[model samples]
Target: MTHVPIRVGIGGWTYEPWRGSFYPPKWPIKRELEYASRHVSAIEVNGTFYSSFKPATFAAWRETTPDGFVFALKASRYCVTRKVLAEAGESIARFVGQGIVELGDKLGPLLWQFAATRRFDPDDIAAFLQLLPRTHEGIALRHAVHVRHDSFLVPEFVALCRAAGVAIVYAASADYPAIGDVSGDFAYVRLEDAREDEPAGYAPAALDRWADAARTLAAGGTPDTFPCVAPGRAPAVPRDTFVFMINGAKVRAPHAAMALIERLGAEPQR
Candidate 1:
């Protein structure tokens, strides 16, 4: 079996609730990213979704994390929430040009999340996907689209992503449409819907189930665990998997992420 890389992490490391529990008590706020980096292989930067960050900030982030730690950035809403997808090229370029290259090899996929109101338009989506640069600052870039509307679950959309080599995010949530289509070379999953009452967000059995699903994904097979709207399964080609424990019980995300990492038999970046 091919040894596919599996990364498990939470949305962001700056949550106040994690200060005392996940982070050490009285730990310097400046060192939060450093602390979190020691426990997880990757982190999804949610702040970038709201605003663009400076190159120095990106450099600082890369410096704080240990080697091999990946940072998956949530693309700015300004780039994806526009009325005309074709007009978003400049905004997309601005977002990408704003120091993302500073992260260097630590940069993982860029997640382009669309609002629930954004319906599927083949031409519009195709144009937006085409605008995504294959490389940024001389480094290859990986793109993932997180579509919320059910209209995006069609086979045509899947084909578009496959052609563009953009991953279709496997979002697991009751409120959002979960599409388990594998359209790109890798798989990106957002495990949302965790329960606050559950200490680890997901029960042990559920974690085990997710681990099995991750293994299946690594082997290039789509797990039947979620609702797949696309026409067929992903080809059995070894691929990397990014599993993020987000939303739901936000406070438990770290624990859940760590549990998933353990289940995958992968070591944290410490």
Candidate 2:
């Protein structure tokens, strides 16, 4: 009856500082994803945001990582950075048809990020959501949206996302608004408050707290203390949870992700 799982990791694998601290001394640059995927259950890939990669590249990535590892890709800027979001169908189609299915089951959620200046226009956002294809190349796709503007805090936006089955990313950042409402069957969390001083990137107690939070999310429950746009709660049902240690104190992100993985108990990334 267990239909939920929690995945924790960092954004991307390559970092100059992690060469020694996170990776083995003088580890081969080409095998960084292979190494990173072993230590964590999931990784949020940022490279897809600016450009496109051939199917072979995605296939190679899948072969390098372990069986249970999952990679979440950021949607292309071309799809989210335009004035007319609804008109992005062509761009969205290009990105979706770009042979990403090469990753097979290793592929996870696609994060669509909007500019901070972009306010919540219910109709525009809804149109853009409709443009997102539920399935591509016979593979089911899960979508998550990240909005930096505070104007997205309105209940209307939350209700819209909920109806569309697209997750609203819980961005734990001082500059962006955090919405912990469960809009989809899955939960996406972007933690951006890592500290340089803490070796684990976060205090021990903080990691413990996040571990608990992740458990709650996987169990189809939202933390009551977290910020929410909607007044009422969604029906609690088992949900897969994804948490990535991102931005803030970027250098310490890997450590923070590893810490979370350790706390969650390494059970072969299932």
Query: Which residue runs does candidate 2 get wrong by more than 4 Å?
Result: 1-4, 267-270
For model 1, the superposed segments whose C-alpha errors exceed 4 Å read 1-4
Q: Which 10-residue window in model 2 sums to the lowest lDDT?
A: 1-10
* RMSD after CA superposition, every candidate: 2.0, 1.9
Residue 67, model 2: Cα distance from true site in angstroms: 1.1
116-203: candidate 2 lDDT, tens digit per residue: 9999999999999999999998999999999999889899998999899999999899888888888988999999989999999899
TM-score of each: 0.97, 0.97
Cα lDDT tens digits for candidate 1, 194-262: 998988999999999999998888888899876776677767898989999999999999999998888
lDDT by candidate, in order shown: 0.90, 0.89
Choose the strongest candidate by lDDT: 1
